[model samples]
Target chain A: MKQRFLKAAAIILWLLIWQILAMIINKELLLPSPYITIKTLISKMSESSFYIALLYSLFRIIIGFLIAVVFAFILGVISGLSKNAEILLSPLITVIRSTPVMSFIILAIIWFSYNLAPLAVNIIMCFPPIYDNVVKGITNTDRKLLDMAKVYDIRPLKIFKGIYLGSVKPFLAAGMNTALGLAFRVAVAAEVLANPKYGIGTKLLQAKYNLETAEVFAWTFMILLLSYLFEYIFKIIIESRRYNAQTRKSDKVI
Target chain B: MLRLENLTKSYNDNYIFKDFSMVIEKNRITCLLGKSGSGKTTLLNVLSSITDEFKVKYSDFEKLRYSYIFQEPRLLEWYTVYKNLQFVLDNTHMSKQAIHEKIMDSLKMVEMEKYADYYPYQLSGGMAQRVSIARAFVKDFDVLLMDEPFKGLDPTQKEDITDRFLKMWRENRKTVIYVTHDLDEALYMAYDIHVLGEHPTKILYTSRNAYKMNDTERENERDKIWQILRSQI
Candidate 1:
């Protein structure tokens, strides 16, 4: 309870600082006060476009993230198992890790329609971390346990389920958490550039272009809210999985 | 009989075992006693085919099923005690009910049937090792290789686990190769004890008690084995 109170207190303190700073600036056009942002946010809650924009953007980013997860996990398992695969995949993984998200956004815009540009950028941005973490997790599996498995003549699929997944799940969960956050950020930025017909990024761009600073702040607040909410939900899922894994009696199906 | 002829193993240009040969009696408990770094575990690994850089010609390698009880439990943390047993038994032709019954029997052997639902993390060290022992026994194998599986147990816990191990071994008399550095453990566990020394990794002494000895005789044998081990040190 004390910790909860302290967290709320800290957030209110920051909001108060923002309000004071806005009052001193006395320019609603440049830096909207917290009160104006909150008011605009409340009013926008009733707007049908707000839900449409959030839902569409949320679907695209989440679908892109899910697809990237599938691809990364498959590639990670292959790379982790075979030295030749790792050698072949290293250059591409390195390129994806090093290249800027903006460069991918531009390339995505050139290759895909406006609706797909953000999703493509999200997948590209999210793959490397998940893949790297999965490979690392599999690589770091306990050799002794593996030896035990071999001596017992455990089938390959059983070893993959009982041993490999036990080692990889935590790393995969951690990587997905980081990848999810990055995917959201890059997805929104891509949407702003692509100017899609229905998205939070589109609404954000419109508010900025019209110099509605309060609406921009409200939209920014909405984005932050959505990002935090999604991450929290993802965290709960990971934590519950970890908890279930710890408590369950049977082998987890990988 | 399981004969490991002219076994040679080296790692990173360091020869841990060179030209080592031993005829391990079938369906008998054989303990490899040595100090730390005396290639005891390396020899076990070679026997189990876990180390690939060794040449060990076995007498009946094709007809053997090998199970290992590692120094650590090595139980899958995600699996409960019963499931760890189930994992090794997956390739067997047993029906699900038969496998479950076998798992329960093994757990009962190790006195861990009550912990069937407990995951590895929930187990105490000795309890986890007992689960590992159960896992080894639950599998259908002709030989069981152990690498100091009882290394970290307290004396009482060690005695309890050793008693259970012996009881289980009595029921299923597979060729057992147990590796350990502890003298008392060697004396307690093996009918045949082979003492190894380092400086080139060779067998220094081999004591075989083909017949069951009384406690006094065993004590005298322990003293003799102690003297042999001391001379090597």
Candidate 2:
């Protein structure tokens, strides 16, 4: 409770500083106060178009993220299992990691429809962290437990499920946490550049063109909120799974 | 008799075993008592076929299933005790119900039935080792290779777990190749004790310990085994 109160106070103090600065500037286009920003956000929330744009961006970004997760997992397992596969794929993964997100967005804009550009950008941006973490998890699985599995003549499928999956889960969760946030930021940036037909980024671009600084601030706030919400939900899901595993009751033998 | 004959194992040109042969009588407790680097664990690993880099010939050991209890508990940290046992027994063609009963029975033998739902991190070291022992017993194995499974426990806990292990062994009479550095452990558990020496490992002395021996005789035997182990150091 105390921590939450302190956090809220810190945010309020920052907002107060912004409000004072905006009042001193005395030009709405140059600087919108927090009050005007909030009012614009509330009005935008009441409009159906705002929801459609929000949903449009949300859906595409989530789908892109899910696709990246699958691809990363498959590639990670292959890389983990074979040195040759890891060697062959290392340069490609390195290039992806080193290249800027804007580069991918520009290339995607040229290759794909404006609607698909953000999705492509999201996938490209989100793949590396998840793939690296997955490979680390697989390679770092406890050797002793693996030897125990081998000695027992455990089936390959069982070993994969019980040992490998268990080892990979925490790494995957951490990767997904980072990737989900990056997905939102890059997807929105892509939408702005690609000019998607319906998206928060398109609305932000329109607001920017019209010099509606309050609306721009409102839309940026929405993006921040959405990113945090998704990250929190993901964290809850991973933690709840671990909690269930820890607390599950065994059957009582008579 | 199960014989491992003409075994040779090396790591980076340093041999641990060379032309080594030992006979393990079936359904009996045979303890390999040795110093730290005497290759006791390497021999156990070879017998269980956990290490394939060795040139070994086995006689009368076909169709044998081996269960290993490592020095550390080595329970899967992510799994509950029940699930750890289930992981091993699931492919044995036993019904789910049978597997459950076998797991519960083994856990009960180890006095760990109440902890079936607990993950390994939740258990004490002794409890986790007991659960590990339960895991080995729950599986279908003709031979049990123990590599100092009771090494790290407090003396009381070790004695208690050892008693429980012997009780379970008495019921099933599986062929057991027990490895330990402790002389008391060997004297208390083995039907036959072999003191092993290091450097291309070989047995220094073999003592057939009759189960009916009195405390004085057992102490005398322990003194003799200690002398052999001392000479190796």
Candidate 3:
């Protein structure tokens, strides 16, 4: 309860700073006050286009993130299990890590349709972290436990599920936690370039063109909220699975 | 019987054992007594085919199943005591009911049946090692390899675990190769004791004590074994 109060206090302090800055600027077109931004956001919620744009942007970004996560996990396992795969894939992963997001967004716009541009950018943005963390997790599994498994001649599937999954889950969760935020940011940037039919990025671009600073802040606020919500949900899922695995104990065998 | 001829194992540039040959008898506890760095675990690793840099001339031994208990308990932390035992049993063709009964029976052997629901971290060092013992026994292997499984216990816990281990071994009669650096431990556990010497890794002494000896006889035997080990040093 005390921690909750401190967190609330910290948020209010930041809002106070923003409010003061907006008052000093004294121009809604240049820097909108927090009140104007919140008012704009609440009014925008009543518009059907707001829901449509929000949902469209949310679906595309989330779908792209999930696809990247799945592919990254499979690639990580392959790279971890075989040296040849690691050698062959290292250069591609390095290039993806080194390249700028804007460069990818430009290339994606040129190479693909507007609908796929954001997804391609999000996938390229999310893959490296997930792949690297998962490979590290797999390669760093306890050798003693593995040796014990081998001595018992445990089946390959059991080894993968029992030992490998137990070891890799934390790294995967961490990677996803970091990648989710980057996915949202990159997807929004790509959508702004591609100017999709209905998306938060499209609204953001329109607001900017019209010099509606309050609308820009409102859309930015929505993106922040969406990113936080997804991260919180992902964290709950990972932690709950870990808790269940740890706390599940049966006195009688099953 | 298990036999290895001309066995050579090395890590990097250092050889722990070279051209080593030994015979392990069937259905008896053979303790390999050696100092800390004298390749006791290396020998067990070789025998279990974990590293696989050896030539074995065994009589149907390679076809038989094997289990290992390491220096630590090595129980999976994610699993409860019951599940740790069940993890190995799941590999077999036994019915689920049979596996449950077997796990219960084996847990009873180590007197850990009441704590079957406890996780590994919830257990004390001694209790965790007992669970590992139960896990090893539940596998129902023809041979069990132990690498100082009771290395860090207090005297009371050590004695209790050793007695419990021997009781389980007596009931199953599996061939066991127990490794230890302590002379008293080897005396307490082994039907045969093989003392290992360093500087090329060969057996310094071999004693066969098939029958239980009284305290006086055991003391005399300890003196004889000590002399042999001391001479090698």
Candidate 4:
């Protein structure tokens, strides 16, 4: 309770500073007050176009993220198991990690239609972290436990499920958490550049062109709120899964 | 008999065993009592085929199945005690009902039946070791390789676990190659004790405890084994 109150106070203090700065500037275009920005956000929420743009960006980004997860898992396992595969893919992963997100967005816009550019950018940006984490998790499985499995002549499927999956889960969770945040930021940036037909980024760019600074702030706040809410939901899901596993009761022996 | 004949192993030209030939009688508890770095674990690893670095001329032990109890409990942290046992048994051809019966029976034998639902991290060290013992016995194997499974416990806990292990072994007699550096552990558990020396490892002394001995005889045997181990240093 105390921590929550302190956090609320800190946020209020920052908003107060913003309000004072806006009053001193005395130009709405130069700096909008927090109240005006919030009012614009509320008005946007009443428009059907707002939901359309929000859903368009949300679906594209989330679908791209899920696709990246699948590809990363398959390639990560291959890289983990074979030295030749790791060597073969090392340079490509390195290039992807080193290149800027804006560069990918530009290339994606040139190579594909504007509708597909943001998704392409999201997938390209999210793959490396998830892949690296999966490989690390696989390589770090306990040697002793693996030796025990071998001695017992455990089936290959069982070892993969019980040992490999068990070790990889935490790493995968962390990787996805990081990639999910990056997904939203890169998706919006890509949309702004590509000028997608219905997206928050397109509306944001329009607001910028019209000198509607309060609307720009409102759109930016919406993206921030969506990103925070999605990440929070993901964390709650992972935590609940772990809690359920830990507290599961044994079945009665007949 | 299970024989390891003319077995040689070296790592980076540091020979752990050279032309080592040993015979293990069937259905007997043979303890390999050696100081650390004396290749006891290496020998077990060779027999289990965990390491393929050894060159063995001939061995008929490949037809047998094995269950190993390592120094640590090595229970899967994600699994409960029952599930750990179930994991091994699930690979066998046993019916699900039979597997459950076997798991419960083994857990009861180890006095860990009440902890069937507990995860490994939730158990005490002694309790975890007992669960490991249950996991080993629940598996179908022709031979049991125990590599100092009771090394780090307090004396009382060690004695108690050893007694429980012996009780289970009495009911189900399997060929067991027990490895340990502790003298009392060898005396208390082995039918045949092989005292080993390091640096191109080989057995220095072998004793058979087939007949029950009085305290004086046991003490003399302990001293003789202790002297042999001391000489290796």
Candidate 1 Cα misplacement greater than 4 A, ranges:
A245-254, B61-63
Clashes of each: 0, 0, 0, 0
Docking class of 3: acceptable
Model 4 Cα lDDT, one tens digit per residue, B1-233? 88878888999889988888888878889999999999999988888878777888888667679999999999888778899998887545778788889999999999999989887777888889999999999988999999999987898999999999999998878899999999898899988888888678888888886327678888999999999999888
lDDT by residue (tens digit), candidate 3, A1-254: 99999999999999999999999999999989999999999999999999999988998889988998999999999998888999999999999999989999999999999888898999989999999988988998889889888889889899888788778888999998889999889999999999989888899999999999999999999999999999999988876676455354532232
Which candidate order results from sorting by DockQ in descending order?
1, 2, 3, 4
Q: What's the C-alpha lDDT at position B187 in model 3? A: 89
Tell me the TM-score that candidate 2 gets on chain A alone: 0.94
Interface DockQ of candidate 1 = 0.55
Pairs that clash in candidate 1: none
Per-residue lDDT over A115-177 for candidate 2, one digit per residue giving the tens place of the 0 to 100 score: 999999899889998999999889988888888888898889899889988999999999988
For residue A218, give model 1's deviation from the true position in Å: 1.1
Instruction: Specify the poorest-scoring 10-residue window by lDDT in model 1 chain B.
Output: B54-63
- Output the number of the lDDT-best candidate: 4
| Interface RMSD (Å) of candidate 4 | 6.0
**Each model's TM-score?**
0.94, 0.96, 0.94, 0.96
Instruction: Judging by DockQ, tell me the better candidate of 2 and 3.
Output: 2
lDDT of each: 0.86, 0.88, 0.87, 0.89
Cα lDDT tens digits for candidate 1, A23-95: 9999999899999999999999999999999998999889989999999999998898887999999999999
Quote the lDDT for A142 in model 1: 92
